[model samples]
Target: MTKDANAATQEKLGGILEARDWSRMHEAWHEDVVDHDPAPDQAPGLAGIVDFWKEFTTAFPDVTLEADPLVVTDDFITAVFTIHGTHTGPFQGHEPTGREFTVRGIQVSKFVDGKIAERWGSTDQKGIEEQLQLGTSDAQFVSKD
Candidate 1:
């Protein structure tokens, strides 16, 4: 892909991520976008992507994604980005934590014919873990064992 094409694709992802418009987000991805979670069962697909965003939205209804520069190879494209959000709802079986946080992450994507076909990513889990404990005595489990 040309530089312009790569840039356009990057911008598109930024837009979709920021908008959280899952209805049309799939169109931006390659038909076979891979979800590369630690568990294979959770790795890859349009449905998986949508599910992820749904959960993410629940965790952060007013979230926004900042797309980093895009790197393109003969077939794969990688983009580094950050997802920032305010935790105002329930997540991970936890009640409304009301914690605001921003997570930095990267997405390694494979594109076929200018469309994203696959992707693997890891977000700023450490930052999120810290944010989840911002206030309150929610941590009641104290086991010395």
Candidate 2:
């Protein structure tokens, strides 16, 4: 991918995430895309991405996602982002404390035919736990295998 194409893809993804437009976002990914950081209940492929967002939005109804600069290369794009929201619903079996949390994360995506074919992500989970006043986060979103 050229630099311009990479920027376009990054912007499109950020727009979709900010709008929470699941349907359109689905079109941005390949059918067999893998989310390395999927939620516990999320299935494989696009369905898993949908489910992951569902769980997140359910917990933070007014969540805001902001994407930072995108580091682009020929075959991959790395996005640094932050999510801010109030905990008003269940999260990892913990009751809501009505507290707000700001979590930062990085997602690196590999492109295939101009669509995201695979992704690996890491988030500030400890920050979330502290903000929520939880001893530890038991959210089993990622695979152990």
Candidate 3:
């Protein structure tokens, strides 16, 4: 991938997150995108991304991503951003808590052709737990990972 191609892939990724376009995300991602689960037990892939976003974006249609600088290279890219959303529905098997939260995370993506070949990202686990009113020490979450 050339530098231009890299930048375009990065831009498209950011757009996917910003638009909350699950269909586009399914299209833009490779069948196997890697994710660095804060909960290490959770393996990462397209199914993980799709499941999380499908429920999250559905609950928070106003979810948005914000950031400034995005790194682009020949076949890799990274973006630092904050995702903001409100809890308007169920999450993590918990009932609505009606809480709003923002989580800052960074993602590095490997591109092959025009699609994301892989990805690894991290975000605020504590904040999510807090927002969901799930006890911080919930053992089920550990097992769920």
Candidate 1 vs 3: which has more TM-score: 3
RMSD of each: 7.2, 3.3, 4.2
49-79: candidate 1 lDDT, tens digit per residue:
6666767677778887666765766666666
Per-residue CA lDDT of model 3 for 14-105, tens digit only, reads 67766766677756677776654423334477776766676666666677777545788888777777777777887666667777877677
Tens-place lDDT per residue, model 2, 46-117, is 877766676677888888767686688878888787878899988767788899988788788888777788
Q: What is the lDDT of candidate 3?
A: 0.65
* lDDT values for all models: 0.62, 0.74, 0.65
Question: What local lDDT score does residue 75 receive in model 2, on the 0 to 100 scale?
Answer: 85
Please identify which of the two predictions, 1 or 2, would achieve the higher TM-score against the true structure. 2
Alpha-carbon lDDT of model 2: 0.74
Top TM-score model: 2
lDDT of 3 at 11: 68
Which regions of candidate 3 fall more than 4 Å away from where they truly are? 17-20, 36-47, 137-145
Regions of candidate 2 where Cα sits further than 4 Å from its true position: 138-145
Model 1, position 53: C-alpha lDDT score: 70
